[model samples]
Target: MNHNIIFQKIETVDLADVAAIEQQCYPNPWPIKTMQDCLDADYQCLKGLTELSPEIRCYAFMMIGHEEAHLLKITVHPAHRKKGLAQAMLHRLTLIARINHARKIWLEVRTSNDEAIRFYRRAGFEIKGKRRNYYRYKDHNGKQIKEDALVMCYSLI
Candidate 1:
């Protein structure tokens, strides 16, 4: 773990750079307005964790309700991936969730993303179920398509 990295609540002003990182990380990402809306709606957790001299290299958005937390999105910049950033952020979020009385944290990942599925498993998330046609995107030829999503959850209580 990098001692220099710091986690802070995300702000609307950080959305542009956050959007750029999102574009780099995902095939399809939530729009900037969507992120802003998360903040405006008082999502349970919206944090940006900085790395390597205070740049916002990683971020996450989560919503906690009725003793459960839903991780809307979590991302690490390409240049910053793998160096314990994701795990560290996950730790932070889990702590926050537990502190807020959340018994578990949940998220949906694209089934096609094997690496992410493995990573989540490594981080103690268990595959709970699958959602058919959970994600939609255009293929390289520009044909629209849908992808299944794997539901995963991590116990916090």
Candidate 2:
């Protein structure tokens, strides 16, 4: 990652940019209200940006509690990808989870997202189990599709 890239807790001012990244990255992005709710719930949220601007190039949402951390979402904008931003965000989240005394960090990924699966695996996240039909979305033809979610975990201790 570039040394100029900075990571900080996301603020309200960053919502629009964060929403745009979500829309661009996911076919079924989380609603703005949901993001707001995460903020309201005081979830662990971080935005990654360059020092030259306030625009968020990447972000992550994780909830830390009960001896574990659950990664709710993570994304790096398409234009800013391939520059190690996503990995940096993941590393930051892992560090935060460890600092909070979490025994493990967990995330669920859509089984079809092969790139993300590989990325998590490379980061030492193991496939622990599956959530059957955990995700539902529509295809280009407007047909509904149901997909499984793979539960992955990284041990912190």
Candidate 3:
């Protein structure tokens, strides 16, 4: 783990690298255009850079509402995993949510993604509910499959 990881606001130009990491992190990564939409008015995108290079090693995309913040996605570059980058991004997002007057932070993770679920729990998020067939993707055979999602929440107030 590098102790010099730096977190900053994500820019449109950074999307390509962000998208690359997205593909590696999920079975169904958001399309590049979809990730572009995350730059809309209500969303906040944060990325982590290390050692003065312009490359982003991790990112957190979030949507902010009147009283809550929703974590749309978070990912760590494959080479940067186990380096606490995700945790750093999560903490930065939490502070951003609080600064925006949000009372809570919310997110959904694929039920099959136990590692992420554990990570979120460690970040103080608790399972609040479940959504059936919340995510759709193709399995190894290329057949469409749907997966349940675990809804989780964290208090910011």
Q: Residue-wise lDDT of candidate 2 within 20-138, one digit each (tens)?
A: 88888887788788888889899998999887897788899999999999999889889888788888898888888989999999999999899889889998999999999999988
How many Å off is the CA of 86 in candidate 3? 1.0
Model 3 lDDT, full chain set: 0.88
- What do the candidate models score in CA lDDT, each in turn? 0.84, 0.89, 0.88
Model 3 clash count equals 0
For candidate 3, the 10 contiguous residues with the lowest summed lDDT are 34-43
The regions of model 3 sitting more than 4 angstroms off are 1-3
How does candidate 1 score on lDDT? 0.84
Per-residue lDDT for 106-135 in model 1, tens only?
999999888788889999999999999999
Candidate 2 lDDT score at position 29: 85
Model 1: lowest-lDDT 10 consecutive positions: 44-53
Greater lDDT among 2 and 3 belongs to 2
Highest lDDT: give the candidate number: 2
**What is the TM-score of candidate 1?**
0.92
Please give the distance, in angstroms, between residue 111's alpha carbon in candidate 3 and its true position after superposition: 0.2
TM-score, one value per model: 0.92, 0.94, 0.93
Instruction: Give lDDT for model 2.
Output: 0.89
